[model samples]
Target chain A: MKGMTIIVKTITRWVKLFIFLFGIYVTLTGHLSPGGGFAGGVILACSFILLTLAYGKEYALSRLSLKTAKSLDSIGALIFLLTALIGMWVTNVFFDNVLQKLFPGTDFMLYSSGFIPLYNIGICLKVGAPLFVTFIVMAAMRIRINDKGEREIIQEEEEE
Target chain B: MFITEIYLLVLLVFMIIAAIIAVEIKSLISSVISLGAVGVGMSISFLFLAAPDLAIVQIAVEVLLLIFLIRATLGREIVSEKGAVTIPLRLLSIFIVLVILGFGIIAFRNLPEFGKPVFSLVPEAPSNSYIQHGLKETGSANIITAVILDYRGYDTLGEATVLFTSLLGALVILRAKTKKNGTKVINHKETKARGGE
Candidate 1:
């Protein structure tokens, strides 16, 4: 696919960075704000989706390849699991806030929440990468109508 | 009636109209757009209901859904077939919907009014303690975040696992299984060659 017109491309180039930053901000500040990991992850995915919509699938895939996305997805889940296991090892309780015991930071600060922000980051990666992959996979199967009015399938080149 | 209530009512009416339009529209693109309108209206309603987190998620997910639906429907010819539902079936479905709506309204009437906590404030409730001690325990200013990530961390972990599993399942189903000899099992090249002309 060639992608949309120049207007969309230009606007996407300008706006996509801010959207990515906002997603990061949301993930980082999940403990202090309304949006947590899930929401932030979705927003991050949207930025990539926006890029795909504007610059075509090839460019988007170049930015974040299937191999990298799959790895990030697994790494995210692993991180979350490791954090929980570490908490259990430290405090003998699953998912306990072990950092809270050591530091016990004050409320409303950026780093006050023990492991919540870490969880947020993990969930964000877990969600964002898979969602982008899903979109890419779904978008690969292209169906178009020919002049004879017959439904035809245009298959994307398979990635190795 | 409060101004917010009026806004909510208006949004609800708009959502209903959009939903009906989505159902009745013949064009797939138009139907998907109308459905997206309904979703946007719903997210707005969530904001009016003071759930910013839900509103954010709803709007983002709605946008993604719209994109996927539109992509699927774009350039596809709708093979017009006979209506699956007869008049009697339509009437029966309408009657069932009305009954459900009536029961829902009755239940709503029995429940506590807006902006009032009924059962959540009870001493035995987990949310009650979370609300009371969330900041002190988790040191997170946002109680919802604290409750979700700290108090209910196990649930969050389970939810993450569920997402991972679903993603894995989708990938597994969609992926083409290839033979070891580098020959394609799901032959897309043949379809592409046929469609190329």
Candidate 2:
């Protein structure tokens, strides 16, 4: 689990925040831009993966624990479902654009897209957190045998 | 547009070269990098085709793919520098290529000219409507986004559910512990140190 060279670590530290911000921007402005939820979420996950690659799992996990990722994953799914349910309650449609009425904001503006951005945000969280957690869980595997002649899996060490 | 065509032709050439390297290269890391180059070339081609959304998504997906692949190959010895291609395997690949080429030749001759659609025969394509009224109806500047989030929302929901299910499945599989000897005990010190509860 030990990280790469110091050069990579320094470069990652410098660029991780910018990558995160770019992912957020892509997710939020999805309606106005090319990148939507899935693309932006993948970028978001890449940023976290980059940090983990540069600084090792232990360092990155300290910042974002597996517990936090699991909760965020569920929260994202719940929010997405809730948004759709609200659509059903109001319009009797499963996934209708509920904001087609009252405040049909102007096109081309950032705030114009009603539920699109909300859905994008929800999807970004759902996609990104789980993806990162999958990487962490997969990478953390350390198999060993104990005194009772039983094979068990444990987390790998931080150091090389 | 003529110059754009030339650029596209060059990009396509590079993409082919990248694809070949991605397959033929001995070093797994080099192969992955070459595959990413193919992705970049495809993204550029998407840009030339006026599909910025596809270009962005393609690039982001390429990055993620590269990361996961590199991670997967970190300690693996799957790729061998000395591994030689067998004659039968090579013959099979050549046969497949010839078949594809034959199909492409027939298809190209039968199909209409580029930039001309046969969609006029079918019912009004949703894409035409999306381009015409996507922004006005959805208030989203990006028609692709509008279509994905508003018009074809059910498909997107299904896709999201698929991703969610895959993640959930991975979680379950990763967390599954084999109950060995009725008392499975991994290194207690490491478990107490930083294991996810």
Judge candidate 1 at residue B107 and give its lDDT. Answer: 97
Give the DockQ-based CAPRI class for model 2.
acceptable
The TM-score of candidate 1 is: 0.66
Give the per-residue Cα lDDT of candidate 2 at B32.
89
Number of colliding residue pairs in model 1: 0
Q: How far is candidate 2 from the true structure (C-alpha RMSD, Å)?
A: 14.1
Query: Residue-wise lDDT of candidate 2 within B1-197, one digit each (tens)?
Result: 99999999999999999999899989998998999999999999999999898899999999999988887767654555777899998999999999999999999898877887766445597667777888788889988888888888888888888888998887665563555555353443657765533
TM-score of chain A of each: 0.89, 0.89
lDDT of 1 by residue, B1-197 (tens): 49999999999999999999999989988999999999999999999999898899999999999988987987566556786788999999999999999999999998887887885646696677787888888888989888888888888888888888988887775566533433333346676566743
Model 1 lDDT per residue over A112-150, tens place = 988888998999999898899889878875445656665
- List the DockQ of the predictions in order: 0.35, 0.37
Docking class of 1: acceptable
Error of 1 at B10 (Å): 50
Pick by lDDT: which candidate is best?
1
The stretch of ten residues in a row with the least summed lDDT in candidate 1 chain A is A149-158
